[model samples]
Target: MKLTPFLAAAAAILIASCGGSNDALDGPSGPAMGGGAGAAGSAGGGTGGAGGTSEPQDAGDSGEDGSNPDAPPGKTAEEACKTYVGAYCSQLGKCSPIYLQLIWKDAAACEASLVPVCVKSLGLPDTAKTPEFTASCGEAIGALDCSSFMGRKVPASCNPPTGPRADGAACGEDGQCANGYCATPLDQACGTCASRAAEDQDCDRDDDCAFGLICSKDNKCTPYVAKGGGCDENHPCEPGLSCKGAVGPTKGSCTDPAGPGQACDTQQIALPGCDLNAGYFCHLVTHVCQKMDLSQAGEACGVVNNGYSACTQSSMCKTNGGMSGTCLAPANSGDACDLVDGPYCVPPLRCVGNVCTELDPAGCK
Candidate 1:
């Protein structure tokens, strides 16, 4: 029932392992689009997450007001970080008051804590700041209706601003690339910028391709396999399709997530059957699809008989050596953490005992 497109579409395999397997995540404060440790502006990244820093930030300080005459033309990445969250929450409040209620104490609380959460996720350094596309990004998010916001069909304005990195420069995030493309190999975190390969060209991941194609078994960027097509770790499926295998069907095939009230195996990891990102889970008693109960960080939480914790995505009910537990907020990478909560560690990093540790690159299967 661990679902939330907030982390790598909730189902896509990623380097952050939960329960000792590759389950890509959008950290409690993970970016909106891409799941693995991508910055807010990276593909499949930017937007949404759990409670942020302890201090409640002033919403007006996000550079939204044209009060600073001495300020630069565009907002800095650090400033834009707050602006993005503020706009997103403000817009979502129009459609999903329930979600906002569960995540924060109130709309004002969301702006304060969540804004800092977004800035931390982007790993902003107060010293090394740069201009970013702010007005358009905030406007695009603020303009979204419930449907578009839920689907997270973010506009291109939210992408990371072009940085100083050159084409051959080594980078870990798209924001570091001047061309806005960081072609990382599947086996590693850092990659060279602007290494786009044509179809049929040798590649290790879809990022290596120039266009809409997947890297096949032979390491060629080719058309993605269609839904219901044969698939495995070696063969890639088309976008939005999950390659799954279950007890009844041992064969792997590209399949769509089960819709509302559809049958599914709640126990199967590769084929949970239900579309978790869409806010559905396989019910234990009815054995049918159902919506999940939301429990934001800082709220009370507990493990029911079935082993499910009500904490929101990227967070966990931390016992902290007590009988009762409270959901803890997601922390930054390299920060202190407890092993109980996924949110305790930032995206791409998992809590290992008392510290957040990076997982193996191969874990992002």
Candidate 2:
């Protein structure tokens, strides 16, 4: 029987998609917080709004008693841009190229809303409110061009401290490279930055391949096997690609998998995968693509062979001592739980020592 459904979550996300999608830019690196230079900090934005960036010109020109002579000048848009953009840039060092794309989509709008708040808070320290700081920091933000981050492949100059490390330059992890990967390649040094390999190029790691391509068993970068092409454990098909037969490379070839609400058409349902991206699964008994169950919190779940059907994707089915279980949403930090492994805790919080707890702030990087 194919018992592969319970493989580690990291493997499911990392290795299965043919070479796998490049996560070069997914989201910003750290907490999306903006701080003021001095006395006037602004509230942070959520999904849509970035916050206010500027203030009225005459707002800061006086002390409390209707007109004291010791007030700072009103803040400028440029100053606001400096404070806001500087805080933003500080976080980009932690973002992957993929994350940069998300920020690019939202940063400008965030800036638009945030600039007014920054301007209003001009009583902030001279570090951000000064003309020199405004000029330089504003220029840096323009150079980043967060609006244009999409469609532009990350280049060598995108790294911190003078730019992304070049090939052969020292590095610790894949995210440090301008090309979005660092390759040590089989017992080699750990810090060398490696560029993505073009099609047909030789490489030892998947990240060495060009975005969207994969390094095959033959150690050459190749286009993702189209539907119906060969596949295996090492050379999985692209996202949405499915294979028939057993799980190994020699045992199967990529084929159209069953869709949600479609016929499974096979007795060995587990051997033929489903469109996991679409949240479909092969039902072993009924032999069809079953729409995943959407059990709510505390609802009964887990019947026979379908473990995942016990809950919605965002929730987990908490089994008791036996086969029966209840769907529960992920717990937040400090919440009590019945299971050790858990449906798991919600983000920023991790299931630690069987309890949900906040992760270190640096973990965001």
Candidate 3:
């Protein structure tokens, strides 16, 4: 079935690098290159989804690991889910502390927040969890460096346990498929197992490829374009680089994004826009990319020279058909959003009938 990568949103968020220094990217209240105060967060504060934190927080390495003395013993698959979650969150927390701070309170809270996601996406059914796979999975996750962690790379050991279902068998999850791929058709809930595609192989979607490869518009599994390489809507550039001059048959070269005061337009992806990872957004009003004051939650936004973003990563701009909007936090499931600050609920949760609601979890489904 035609499918998108489960980490598609995460991939977009990767443009917001965790660490970098920009002269126009100082803290809020500081002087910017062209006009207004430098924003508190980096250029990608409003990029939304995960990794919205634009500036580098440097919260230090998350000390916990599967090997930590105080860590829980993952003797069962259920417990191993926790171990895997901890290993992932630990590295993520240290990569961008401020973003996590905006959501959960601490490392433990962060782990708690993301555990269900990891478990639901890559884990076995509650009745199917086994310990033999748990230990190896947790250890593999704990060994991931920041690059792999940020890329959402799945360790070989972390793959779902092999099952009796053969390729082409009806399956609801990866664990049920012998080939480890459940080829769900677009807009369908169920799928069948299929063999994975390799680089240069024909493919219809991202999930058909093996690790580190993505399906291109040409319907082939290919590696991501490197920095300074030509790319377009069909040819995606590597994370941290933006495409410039990509239009029609002529491809654009991936280049470092523009900094604050640089000319930009969100409508034009081919242009060398602002540094998205730094929390710089293109201001439609001024037609220039500018840093937003991330600390300006509850403050008015969308005004003249206010940049595309006025709030922190966790929050969004809520404009109710007015000339201006306010920055506010997201609501939880079943929470009333009528009086909330942002326009909508958090990622993975949407405003359904004015209440935040959960959607299908990523992967397999």
Best by TM-score: 3
lDDT by residue (tens digit), candidate 2, 54-146 = 000011211121222222245455564555345443333222211222222234433443343334322222111232323333333334432
Give the CA lDDT, 0 to 100, for residue 169 in model 3. Answer: 67
- Tens digits of per-residue lDDT, candidate 1, 148-232, equal 3443233444433454667887654444556544554322344565644666787654334433343454677554455777655
lDDT of 3 at 19: 7
- The candidate 2 region of ten consecutive residues with least summed lDDT is 48-57
- Once superposed on the true structure, which residue ranges of model 3 sit more than 4 Å away at CA? 1-74, 93-109, 116-147, 159-161, 167-172, 183-192, 196-205, 215-221, 259-271, 283-289, 292-305, 310-365
Candidate of highest lDDT:
3
Candidate 2 local lDDT, residue 73: 44
Query: Residue 21, candidate 3: how far off, in angstroms?
Result: 35
Candidate 1 positional error at 156, Å: 4.0
Q: List TM-score per model, in order.
A: 0.47, 0.41, 0.57
RMSD, one per candidate, in order? 11.5, 16.6, 11.0
lDDT computed for candidate 1: 0.41
